[model samples]
Target: MTQPQGALLVGSIAFDDAERTMRTAATELGGLLRRIPDGEVGPRFHWIMFQPDVLGQAEGIERVGEERIPLRMLDARPLRVADGVDPREIRFPELGYARAARESYALFRRLREEGVIAPGMRFQVSLPTPLAVVGAFFPPEQRAAIEPAYREAMSREVEEILAAVPHEDLAVQWDLAVEFQIIEELPGGVAAWWDGAWAGVVERAAWGVDLVPHDVEVGLHLCYGDVAEKHFVEPRDAGNLVRFANAIADAARRVPAWVHLPVPIERDDDAFFSPLADLRLPEETELYLGLVHREDGAEGAQRRIAAAQRVVPRFGVATECGIGRAPAGTTEGILRTHAEVAAPW
Candidate 1:
C-alpha cells in the first residue's frame, strides 16, 4: 500500500454556494473557521467544494419542466403535480457549474504555479452526485426527469476539468449518500429506485474516467447526509453496515475507484472495525477513513486519528461530512489540524 505524504480531503471547501446562500457573509465565516482548524499546518491542503451549481454549468443544460417530485418523507398524492405542464416557463435558477469548474481549476493551477504549494503537492476536487444536485435545486417532481440530462452534462464537465488539471495531481470524489438507504429499504421498495435511478451515477462517473489522461485519482465517497441526523443515521446495526459495505464492494468491482467511510464515532471500535478488519481492497483502490469528528477540536482530532491508526492502516483521513454548513473558524481549524497530522514523516 502507498502511504499518502500529505492529506487529500473529501470534505467541504471554504467557498459558499451562490445559489443556495449569499456568499459574502458565509465566506467570511468560513474563512474564520478555517484559520483555527488549520493550526497554521503541515501536509499541504486542497479545499474541496461540493458545488452542484458548478456541475450544472459544466453540462450546458437546464431543467425545463414543471412537476413536484414526491419526497420520501412527504405525502405522494398531494405533492404530485399535473402532467404536461411546460417546464421551460418555470424560472429555475441558472447555475454556472461548468464556469465554476473552470475557475476552480484556474485557481488551483495558480496556487500550484505561484509557489503557494511546494513541489510534489496534490489538490483534490469533489463534486456531489446527480441525485444530490437535483434534490437541492429542483422540486421533487422535477428531480427524476431533470437528473438524467444533468448527469449526462456532469460527465462533460468532468471531461473539461480533466483537460485542464494535472491528472496525477488531482483526485475526484463522487459523493453517494444513497448506498446506506438502499439496504434497509431494499426488501421494501427503495431498491427499485436505486436500481432504476441511483445506479447510473456509477457508470457515468466511470465513463468520466475514460475522458481523463490516465493516472488521476478517482474515488467514490458514501455517507449518510450533509449534517442532519435523519432516517439514514438512526442507530444502525452490524447487519446494516454489512449490507452497505457489500453493496459498495460490488460498485468498486465495476469502477476503478476508492471507497470512503466515516470512522466509528457513534459506535464502539469493536463494532466498527471487526467486519472491515479483514476485508480485501481492490489492487489499485484505497480505503479512505473519515477520521475527524465534526465538533472535535485539536485534542479530539488527535485522539480520533490515534484511535483510527490503531485499527486501520493505509487509510485516508476525512471529515464526518461536508463542512459547508459549518462556520469557517471551526472547519478551518479542523482541516489544518488534519493536514498537519497527515504530513509526511
Candidate 2:
C-alpha cells in the first residue's frame, strides 16, 4: 500500500480553548502537520451556524424567526432586508473572524516561542466563502442583493487578518460547503443566482484565492454539508470534486497551495476514488483526502488510504470535516488516527 504523507486539520477542533487545541495537536500530530487552527471554539464551534446573529446585527438585516431553531444551539434563522431598506446599503460590523484570528495567533505565537508548537508550523485561518454566509443566512431573493455587501465585508476581514498576522506564518483556507449544495442541487439547498452553477462557484473561489497575497499560502476546502455528522448528500464519486478543483487551478491567479476533498466513511472502494485519476493539480499543490473517521480508528483510514493510493499515488489525510462539533471524548482518538495512518512530514 502507498503510505500517506502528512495530515491536515480542517479548521475546528473540539478542545475547550485555542491553547489546549494547539498544545494537544502539537503534542500528538506535530510532525505531520504543516499548519494548525484555533479549534473554532466559542461561537464558531458549529462552523458558520453563528453567522446569522452577526448578520442580524447589521441595520437593515433582521432574523425571520423570533426564537432559535429547534434542536440547534445557535440562532440559525434566515434574515431579511427590512422594509424600505436596501440590502446593498447595509454595513456589517466586524464579522468576528479577524478578531478571533488575531486573538488565536497571540496564543499560537506564545506556544511556538515557548516550544509547545513547532517553529515551522503556519497558523491556519479558515473562512467560509461569502456565498456560504449569504446563502445560509438570507432568503433566495435577498442573496444576490446582499452578497456583494457581505463579500466586501469578508474581503475586509481577510485584509484585517492578513494585516494582523504575518504572511510567512499564516495560511488561509476558503471553506466551500454551500457551493456543493448549489452544485448538487440538493433539495432546499441554495440555488445559484448567477448564470451557470459551475462557473459561478469557480468564479467565487478564484476571487477568494486572489484576496491573499502570493507570498502567503492559501488553500481550498471543498465540502458537502456536515450537519449533525452527515453530508447533505453523499457524492456519487470524486468527479465533481476533480472538475471543480481543476477549474480553480486554472482560474485562480495563484494556484492554491493545497485542496482538500472529503471522503465518506463507507466509501473505501476503488469506484469512489477512481475519478481522482483525472485530477490535474499542479505539482506544487497538495491533495488531502478527508478519510479519517474516529468511529473506525486508524484501521479504517488505512483502508480508504489504500483505495485512494490506487489512483493518486501521493496525498495527505484529514477528517471529512472539522471536529469542533464532535462528541466529547472523541477528539483525542481522532487526532491519534491521523498520526497512525500517515507518515511524518
Candidate 3:
C-alpha cells in the first residue's frame, strides 16, 4: 500500500491558547506538518458560530429570534436587517478573523524564533468563506441583500491578514463547511440564495482563492457541518468532494496549495474511497483526507489509509475536521495519531 505522507491540521486545535496549540502540535507532529494554525482559540473555538455576534455589531442588523443566542453556542436564531434599514448600507465591524490571526501570528513568530516551532513551517490562518458566515446568520431572503456587504468585509479581513503576515511565512485556508450542507440540500441546512448551487459554491470558492496573492500559499478546507463532532450528512462516497475540488481547480486562478476532505469514522471501506480515482487535482496541489478519528486512533486511520491507497497512491491525513471540539483529553492522542499514521514530510 502507498503510505500516507505528511499531515494537515484543518485549523482549530482543542488547546485553550495559540501558544499551547502551536507548541504541542510542533512537539508531537513535528516534521509531519508543513504548516500550523493558532488553534482557532477564544470566540472562534466553535468555528463560525461566533460570527452572528460579529455581524450583530453592525448598525442596521439585529437578532430576530425570541431565545437569546449565547456567545459560542450553536443556536439557530438568525440575524435580520432592522426595520427601515438598508442591508446594503450595513457596515460591519472587524469580523474578528484578521484580529485573531494577527494576534496568533505574533505568538507563532515568537515561538519559531525560540525554536519551539520549526523554522520552515508556515503559520496558517483559516478563514471561513464569506458565504459561510452570511448563509449561516441570515435568512434566505436577507442573504442576497447582506452577502455583498459581508463579502466585502471578509475581503478586507483577508487583506489585513495579508498585510500583517509576510507572504513567505503565511498560508491561508478558506473553510467551506456550509457550502456542502447547502449542496447536499440537507434538512435545516442553509439554502443558497443563488440560482445554481454548484455554480454559486464554485464561484465563491474561486473568489476566495483569488484574494490571496499567488506568492503566498492558500488552500481550501471542504467540509460538511461539524456539529458535536459528527458530520451533518455522511458522504456515501467521495464523489461530491472530488467533483467540487475539480470544479474549484478549473475555476480558480491557481490551483490551491492543498485541499482537505473529511472521512467519517464508519468509512474504512474501498467503496467510500473509490471516487478518489477520478480526482483531477494538479500534481502541485496536495490532498489530505481527514481519516484520523480519536475514537479509533491510529489503527482506524490506517484502515482508511489502506482503502484510499487503492484509488490514489499519494495523500496526507487529518481529523475529519478541526480537533477544537473533540472531547476533552483526546487532543494529544489525536495529534499523535496523525504522526503515527503518516510519514513525516
Best by TM-score: 2
Q: Model 3: per-residue lDDT, tens digit, 1-345?
A: 667999999999888999999999999998999999999999889988888777887899888878886654545467999989988788999999999988999999999999999888999999999898888878788889988999999989999999999999999999999999888998888888989999999999999998899999999999987878889899888999999999999999987999999989999898899999999999999999999998889888898899888889999999889989888888999999998889998
Clashing pairs in 2: none
Better of 2 and 3 by TM-score: 2
What candidate 2 gets wrong by more than 4 Å, as runs, is 70-73
- In order, the Cα lDDT scores of the candidates are 0.47, 0.92, 0.90
Q: Which parts of model 3 are misplaced by more than 4 Å?
A: 71-77
Q: In model 1, where do residues sit more than 4 Å from their true spots?
A: 1-6, 15-82, 85-95, 134-146, 184-213, 228-257, 302-311, 339-345
lDDT (10s digit) by residue, model 1, range 260-293: 6665455444555556655555665665666556
Candidate 2 lDDT, 1-345, residue by residue in tens? 867999999999998799999999999999999999999988898888888878889897878977777425577787888989977689998899999999999999999999999988999999999999888878887788989999999989999999999999999999999999999998888999888999999999999998899989999999997878899999999999999999999999997999999999999998999999999999999999999997898899999998998899999999999998888999999999999999998
Report lDDT (Cα) of residue 13, candidate 3. Answer: 86
Per-prediction TM-score: 0.64, 0.98, 0.97
lDDT (Cα, 0-100) at 323 in candidate 2: 90
Evaluated with lDDT, which candidate comes out highest?
Answer: 2
Q: Could you give me the TM-score of model 1 versus the true structure?
A: 0.64
